[model samples]
Target: MAAILSGDRLRFLLGRFKDRLWVKPLVVCLLSIVAAFIAKLVDGTTLAQHVPEIAAESVETLLSIMAGSMLVIATFSVASMVSAYASAASTATPRSFTLVVGDDASQNALSTFVGAFIFSVVALVAVKNNYFEAAGLFILFVLTVCVFGMVIFTFVRWVDRIARLGRMGSTIEKVEKAATAALKRRRNAPTLRGVKLTSEPHGRTVVATSVGYVQHIDIAAIQAWAEENDVRVIVAALPGTFAAPGRALAYISNLSREQGLEQKQEDFDDTRVVRSFHIGPDRLFDDDPRFGLVVLSEIAGRALSPAVNDPGTAIGVIGTLLRLLVLWGEPAVEQDEQAPSYDRVEVPEISVRDMFDDAFTAIARDGAGMVEVAVRLQKALHALALVGDPALRAAAEYHGRLALKRAKAALAMEEDYTAVRDVAMFSETGSQRNY
Candidate 1:
């Protein structure tokens, strides 16, 4: 069990659980109940005598106030969060709803309100039933005061966060942050700490059992299975790939063929191999960096739509994409100069061209007629072409030329066409030309 739930797999599961709305509130509620009972332990302690007695009426009044106000506040918070989720889905892309919903400030505030409400109700019930002595009552009073302070602090912070929670700029920023983190992880571990799959895999194919997007691959688990079975596993599908029952998830080749252990390949559990590839109805941003880029592009496309006609937002998204792409192009620091951690597992690297396509293809097509967006995009692409990474330069140049072609066809005015073409000259000649 420990081996199966270790490393990235554990982190992935925890990350998913953390995003749930009920998880934090449930934990906080449990803690609140525990705190209510813990004060009872001070009933026979000498420390209770040292603490001044808190008036029963005063404590009761405070708990009653908290119980009433916190319940109202929690309800208001839920309504506000639901509104924000709807706004994020409507204004931005629906794909970004998860990021908006999983906001830490919003979740923490809701948890605090719910927890405070539970604490007050529980304390009120205990007080009415004569469950606490003078010493226990004093402790409970102090805990109640602390809970009040926490509620106030959380409410203030949450107010500030909720103001901009569902705005387009905030949504885009959240997507960019997610994209940056995923890109950084991929950059550091290009093959996911596995041997690079440079050539076509030649072995027994392991097909997926489900049909959905590949959300994560447990490289450590696959490596363990490979070691135990004396075989080399080549992962065919990376995160974000669509998995189907007929699609090959991996290829297993017998490593001990010289020892006449080839027969063992027939006994390989394909179920175990399929389990390492997590399939979900939708792609996740945690392991699939391209999903972030795609979502960002979707937001830009929506902004550039005929009904929206918000070219400025599209231009802003281009800048955000540039920042992420530049981060991806940066030199990665190697943690170990030796062999990869999962030597028995081989996986393919994410293609830079695909990243560029995911990041800019839709924006270019949607904003083609808008000269402002077109010019800014060409300049952004030009900037990327000079980033010094050959793959980055090539992808940027290819996209730049493609966007220029789109602009030329869409722009009827000669001046608008000329303006975009001059900026795009950098992609063709490696330097911008003065018109």
Candidate 2:
């Protein structure tokens, strides 16, 4: 529970930092102010003699110039990013705008520029006020030079990333990275280290109080609540699940009652469990790989639209999906040294079939007319079939056949039709089956 909470807290903090560019720059400004104070404390006898060449007036002029220029550059950087976000939303789907806006390289570049400006201004003021002795003044000059170097380096890198920030390829990579992380986490703890709730739950059903998608579940809180109530919690709705106001979010089963304790027949408390599950209007990427796949599909769908007519982009998306499926198809390790985090809490594993469908369905539907996309889809499915997981193989086979059928109906050219059907042979358990 501590581990889970700590990890969640760290992830939450990181999400906050990524969303806003000010936090890092704010910290940088504070540190620069502290550095000025620290410079006053350091002795300045020998270093002052050696570094006398750096006149205080020259240092102040340099700092002021850097402060002015960096501020202007930072403003231009923000405007350019806003433009990039708009272009990404217009060219690709708006779903990818969040990733583009929160891009680390661009954010760090802007933060560096802002931080440098703040550092220079504060250091300039300190120098003019004689807050720094000779050594401290020298130290400030050295740090200013270092800051200048960082600005140049960061600006160069930002230039490269800004160009591709909202482009189709970069968007695909961003979504893939996020989905891969989520999938890896799901693979590690498929059931959230709790028993699978297979049959109908026996205890009281805890209905959702609101209508939304389940964004996150506090497993530790649920376990603690279950322990206090002497019950087991069967999670009915995992993250990414849509919950109606009256739908069951979880089920509570009373465990062993104490020997001398009397069992109360009153209502079970559902507040804690309900509060533990966070629901929102849309799905989140942190705990939900399906959302990432959905966005990827949206990108492909836009590419296949008449205005875009970019089958190559769709093919590239299909390739990325194949990589994701391959990572997900790898066998899950069965051994776990530690006990399940929530001994009395149960959670259902995410459905592999659903993930596969979420990933490939729309792309297959939208790209059915293009022979390049159709062949690549079939080949990708056949490759997944080679992973030897029957369920995944079966899902792949189903989508493959469906995509081939769609191609058959949509493609007017016989050569294009033959090209797709030719690659539909799927090998399972040493036996080859043509879709």
Candidate 3:
């Protein structure tokens, strides 16, 4: 359990750090300062004399030019990134801003610019103070040339990426990728490596202490606690659940009832159990597969609005949702069928109906009047119904009927309504009717 908790915690912390804009740049800046001092190691050695005599004026001129140009470039990069973030929020959904901001290419470009600028400034200071011998100056010059080449390479790549970074297609692709990964993770571990909670357990309720979304649940920690206390824990609120002061986070039942009064409800540490659930102001995409689906639907909804009127994007999102949903219906690999790692912890599986609702409900409602969108949506749902999973087929059929009904009402032309109805053809028992 300790090993499990350590790996989980490490992954969580690394994910959090990767999302921050400053962490990479700060580390690069520190490395830049260190690199400036490292060249001084050969200051007093005979190697200093044997090395080529590079003029101090030439080095100074190069460093001065880099310092001035790099600062301006860094400022421009920051402005461009800010614009990209704003465009993603306005064009797509604001919830997608995190994924856009965490883009590796943008962050790496920014870090390189800042790091180069710092290196130039430090090198300039060292030159003016006469801190380096001949060897040190030569090494510094070589490092400066390498830095210049890296900057050029990074800037060119960043230019290409920034051009399409916040555009509709790019945004949809990003959201789809995130949603796909989350869906795959949840599909593999439906109960989070714990026993499935079939029904409500009779136990003492453990309520949350704060108001926020449940971002991460440390099942390993909870399992360890349950094992130590000889209790069985039923997780009431999964990730993405909105938690509040009075909301139940989990339930704890004494497993050692035969051992008598020593293991009673009063002895339970509610605080420890509550602490295992990390609450935050907003839901995260890492642990909450539903959040990603919700964001994708939001983008489609906005595109279908009168102000945007981009049905192509909505159609594209439907295709993306289809790919993600297919993953949900895939059978788990043999490794996943082994015994549960956290036997004492029981967690409820994600609802298939809820997943379909999050992925398609808004798009179905918003795009009902458009014949192109309506036809595409019905086709997508019809395709999902063909997947082998019974639960998936049922949910897909339910949503298909609902979307068909919505289109029939919103679309004025009888021909347009007929078009949607022809594609849907939903029937009970996962069978399709001939049009």
- What TM-score, over all chains together, does every model reach? 0.96, 0.91, 0.95
Query: How does model 3 fare in lDDT?
Result: 0.89
TM-score of 3: 0.95
In model 2, which range of ten residues has the least summed lDDT?
A: 426-435
| 2 against 3, candidate with superior TM-score | 3
User: Any residue pairs clashing in model 1, and if so which?
Assistant: none
Deviation from native of the Cα of residue 230 in model 1, angstroms: 1.4
Task: Count clashing residue pairs in model 3.
Answer: 0
Write one digit per residue (lDDT tens) for candidate 1, span 2-64.
448777898899989987999999999999999988899989889876989888889899999
| Residue 341 in model 3: lDDT | 93
**Candidate 3 positional error at 430, Å:** 13
What lDDT is reached at residue 198 by model 3? 85
Please report how far candidate 2 places residue 416 from its true position, in Å: 2.8
Q: Write the per-residue lDDT of candidate 3 for residues 202-263, one digit (tens) a residue.
A: 69999999999998888888988898898999999999999999899999988778456455
The lDDT for every candidate, in the order shown, is 0.91, 0.81, 0.89
Comparing 2 with 3 on lDDT, the higher-scoring candidate is 3
Q: Alpha carbon lDDT of residue 407, candidate 3? A: 92
